[model samples]
Target: MTTHLITGAGSGIGAVLAQRLLERGDDLVLLARSASRAAELAASYDGARTVVADLADPASVEGLDLPASLDSVVHAAGVVELGAVADLGVASWLEQLTVNLVAPAALTRVALPALRAARGTVVLVNSGAGLTAHPQWSAYAASKHGLKALADSLRTEEAEHGVRVSTVYPGRTATAMQEKVHAQEGKDYDAADWIDPGTVAATILHLLDVPRDATVPDITVRPNA
Candidate 1:
């Protein structure tokens, strides 16, 4: 069984992804900021382990230690604070960057030892905003742009070691993060029109199923209605 490490396993796509992996007989290490939710999910999987780490605080991720032979990693923990650029608070902006960009990069760096050993893959869950911008989404777009760049660069840097990097850019998934921002903005967006979390989770699993010789550099999924 392959050992997979996932960040943001508390809810949304992360929670669904954890369940999918567990059902497929993958050993897992779930990293999240909430202990209660982590424990709940851990109990459902036979070999699932949980680590409480706040991505906003980089130091929190530093103390974590995973097996030196992890087969895969999914960086799904992210934040989206929507508002006019001028109204964006410094603290809110920093928190977005810390969780979406800095923490993922830091965790990947720390896990390089194990990834290289297993010739594992790194999966980054980015946003369509990272590719194209829109109003009231500056912070989210900027952080996702950074994540995209990091994923691209890491792909080249780690390729020689037989490690692969894959990135997924999904448009408006039905996640709590999306719902929270939608509620705050009062935009009344339709969740049914967005990509499905289960479908996205299946995509991640597909990437994992690909033969080692195959590489899916980047993929974007959007609902068509």
Candidate 2:
């Protein structure tokens, strides 16, 4: 069975992806900021293991104990801070970049040896913000854009190791994070206005299903009107 490790498995797209992978008979190692949530998920799944770690902390990521080999590592943990560049505090900006960009890079680096051993795949869950910047979203946009650059660089560098890196850019997925974003925007939260997290999870699964000789490096999933 393929073994996969997923960060942010406590909620949202990460949790949904874990469920999908479990249903498909893959072994999972779930990492989340909430130990209780990760434990609950592991208990529900027959062979899933839980690791509680704050991905924003470099020390926490560097010390992660993982299997010697892994079929995939999905960096689904992220944070967003919305404000015009002039109004956003340096702390908020750094926090957003740390969680949304730096943490993924650090975790991927830690997992590189295991991933290389298995000739595995690395999936970065990015956002449409990575593709375009809008008003009051400067910090978040910059972090995601950095994430896109990270994925692109990793794809090229790891190709020689027979490892594939793919990135999914989803447009406003309906999750707790979307609710937070809507609240910050002073708009009523409407799930209908966003893409479904399951749809994004399905797309990642498709990327993994492709033959080893081929790769779908980048995918964009936008909400339909």
Candidate 3:
């Protein structure tokens, strides 16, 4: 059976991806910010399993109980609080940096041995903001940019071990996070205006389902409007 460990399985693309995998009878280990949150996800995903950790606190990653060998690690948990460089407080900057970038790197480090043993994949769910920065997206973009760098370096370092690293950059997706972004921008959100999270989830699954002989280093998904 295929096994995938995923963060942010509670919602958005991760949630859709988890549901698809579960329906196909794949094994899953999901991350939850707290024990209560873990319970919620357990019930939501039909009691698959979960590990408790706050992505905003990178130190919490050191305690994650990951499987000995697994097929994949999907870093989909992220937070964004849009503010210009001039006004974004240090707390906001730190939280985004820790959750969106630092925590993934730390978690991947601990999962390396298991990944190598299985010659698995590590997929990082990034954003279009990772590629282009607008006026109020400084902190979030910087963290995602750093995440891209992390993946590039890891891809090379782990190549000999046969573990593939891929980063998927999705354009504005209709998720609670996008709604928050619209609220910050003082604009109304219309889910129909954005790409469906399930579409992006399908893209991630394609990368995972491909034949073992080849690997995709990066992919970008954008709305067709």
Candidate 4:
């Protein structure tokens, strides 16, 4: 059975992706921030395994217990706080950077062996902010940009091992994150105006379904409307 370890499976795109994978009868392992979250995920996705690690503290990701082998590791969990460069506090920057960048790196480093054993794929669910930075998004964008760099470098380093790396940049998805972003922007949010979480999740599923003979390096998804 193909096995996948997913972060951010509690909500939004990650949650939708987890459900899709489960519906297909795939072996699923979810990364939870706490024991309570793990229990919730277990109840939500029966037959799925869970590992606890707090992304807010990157150090927590080190030496985490994981499956012996995995077909994919999807880094979908992230945090975002919006404020001007001059207004954003150091703690805010560190929080976003730790949860969005450092923790994923730490977890992926630990999962490399399992990924290599399965010739697995590493999918980083980035943001459009990763590509182009807007005002009040300095910290979050910086972290995402770093995430892109991480994927690019890891792609080259892991290629020889047949491990693939991909980064998906989804724009304004109708997830809780989007709601938060809207609130930060002080704008009204309508789900119909944004991309559906399932759409982004489907694109991720496509990356996983791609033949071994070919690989997708980066994908950027935006709402048509």
Which number leads on TM-score?
Answer: 4
Worst 10 residues of 3 by lDDT: 56-65
Q: Output the number of the lDDT-best candidate.
A: 4
Quote the positional error of residue 4 for candidate 2 in Å: 0.5
Count of clashes, each model: 0, 0, 0, 0
Candidate 1, 115-175: lDDT as tens digits: 9999999999998998997898998899999999999999999999999999999888988
TM-score of each: 0.95, 0.96, 0.98, 0.99
> What would the per-residue lDDT of candidate 4 be over residues 1-225, giving only the tens digit for each residue?
999999999999999999999999999989999999899999999999999999987788787888889999999999999999999999999999999999999999999999999999999999999999999999999999999999999999999999999999999999899899999999998999999999999999999999999889999999898
Looking at model 2, the pairs that clash are none
Which regions of candidate 4 are displaced past 4 Å?
none
* lDDT at 150, model 3: 98
Worst 10 residues of 4 by lDDT: 57-66
lDDT of 3 by residue, 108-190 (tens): 99889889989999999999988888899999999999999999999999999999999999999999999999999999999
Model 3 residue runs over 4 Å out of place are none
What's model 1's lDDT at 87? 94
lDDT at position 105, candidate 4: 92
- The residue-by-residue lDDT of candidate 2 on 1-225, one tens digit each, is 899999877778988898999998998998867667767877876789877778668568777888999999998888887998889999999899999988888889999999999999999999999999999999999999999999999999999998999999999999999999999999999897888899999998888788998988899999996
* Pairs of residues at least 3 apart in sequence or in different chains that clash in candidate 3: none
RMSD for each model, in Å, please? 1.4, 1.3, 0.8, 0.6
State which candidate, 2 or 4, has the greater lDDT. 4
